[model samples]
Target: MVDEASKDGLNALAQAAKQAPRDSPRDSTRRGLPPVHLWNPDHCGEIDIVIRRDGVWMHEGSPIARKELVRLFSTVLRKDPDGYHLVTPVEKLRIRVDDLPFRAVSLGREGDDLIFVTDVGDEVRAGPDDPIMVQTDPITGEPAPRIHVRRDLWARIARPVFYELVEMAEEVDGQLVVRSGGQAFPLGAVA
Candidate 1:
């Protein structure tokens, strides 16, 4: 159960997140992300924001419907030692993330680079800096694939996108591997 003060703080943070794009001259849908890492505000708290496993942003148990708003909020998202936080110049608010925060919804190839576009409009090229990682679920033994986006943030490759990657993979030493930016990332054992 949330206390009244917490509720108020959550609502206020939501409002602030909404207003952030309007406060900026550039469009929130633009490619560049805010300097969230640089901000070290004195005020810190938690809100009801949760990034679901499927990459949907939920607030107070409801989905945040606006794409641009979500994009704006994504710009300020940062991961610290404790957890993920939405950082601004004035305040910092921790948020819950069930899995990762972003989803790699689309994939494209340019030259030798594999470019991934996140749901919130981040374009990350899989390379040494942003490597692809596949982890096996210990319980289900299913493959969970992810790609690094920026800083410590990552985008879970959507199933269809992962299938696309698999389609592009080649068998190398009994393992399925995909090449991007001169790096070979193993998908899994070729079964």
Candidate 2:
């Protein structure tokens, strides 16, 4: 069953977590990432882990409460056409992501730059490199907003945080746009 698989996967995750170096992700702006993009290690296997839409990391059919471990694993996370996977020097394990892998928990403004703090404590500033995008569900027609963190990874802006963004939006060309780093990112139409 999936439960058994999750248990085995958790053990692997725990072991892998220990191997991952404890580095300050807060300094990502100054230093580059771990070069997961460049590392094309062979796929080890699938891991029975799933990141829920609410930003919960589930292992062994239970939520992973260790924030530090989650942060460490996040460093190796990569996205490809197949799906999301956690990569290391020796192996790579595929993991299920119901939505985005991260959630934007808070937001701040410094001058013209907008900074977002993810649940795992990743701070990203919106600019040309990282941009905010809003996608409307085709079936439900509800807006789902996400902000790019690094490479191809994105953090879904939490609903309450999205409300704060809506409050800060300005009407430009009949579109709701928020300015950050002197760049304007359109949320959607002013409906």
Candidate 3:
């Protein structure tokens, strides 16, 4: 159950997120991301926000249904030593993340670069700066692939997107690899 203070905090966060200044349009790809890394506000406290493994943002035990609101809040998201937090110029509140905060829902190719679209609308290009990494579950041996989205933030590649990548992979030195931004990323050992 959520306490009254928690509820108030959540409401304040939502309001602050909505009221935050946005100079650029809502296009994640074309506009510049908010400079959340530079903000060092005092840690206000914890808020009842959870980003599920499936990339759904939950607040006070309910899913936040507004897509625009989700996108807006995502701009202020930052990962610190303690955990993920929603940061602004004045306040910073820790939030729980079950897994990575974003999901790579779509993949496309632009010349030699592989561009990924995250569930929240950020477009990231895989390259030396933002490389792709895959980890196999020790117990299940299932491949879990992720792509670097921004500073200390990564997006889990969805199963379907991973499959698409596999279909585009090429055999390179006994490994299935994909090239993007002039770099080769290994999918796995050729099987």
Measured over all alpha carbons after superposition, the RMSD of each candidate to the real structure, in angstroms, is 3.7, 2.8, 2.6
lDDT of each: 0.85, 0.85, 0.88
The alpha-carbon deviation from the true structure for residue 177 of candidate 2, after best TM-score superposition, in angstroms, is: 0.8
- In candidate 3, where is summed lDDT lowest over 10 consecutive residues? 22-31
Q: What are the runs in model 3 whose C-alpha is more than 4 Å off? A: 1-8, 18-30
Best by TM-score: 3
In candidate 2, position 22 carries an lDDT of 42
How many pairs in model 1 have backbone atoms within 3 A of each other, for residues 3 or more apart or on separate chains, i.e. clashes? 0
Q: Return the TM-score for candidate 3, rounded to 2 decimals.
A: 0.89
Alpha-carbon RMSD, candidate 3: 2.6
**TM-score to native of every candidate shown:** 0.86, 0.87, 0.89
lDDT of 1 by residue, 1-191 (tens): 55688668756765665544333336443254556666688757787889999888988888888887788788888899999998876789889999999999999999989999999989888999899999997878899999998889999999999999999999999999999989999999998
Extract clashing residue pairs from model 1.
none
Q: Give the TM-score of candidate 2.
A: 0.87
Best prediction by lDDT:
3
Tens-place lDDT per residue, model 3, 87-122, is 877899999999899999999999989999999998
Q: What's the distance in Å from true for residue 49, model 3?
A: 0.6
Ranking by lDDT: 3, 1, 2
Q: Judged by lDDT against the true structure, how good is candidate 2?
A: 0.85
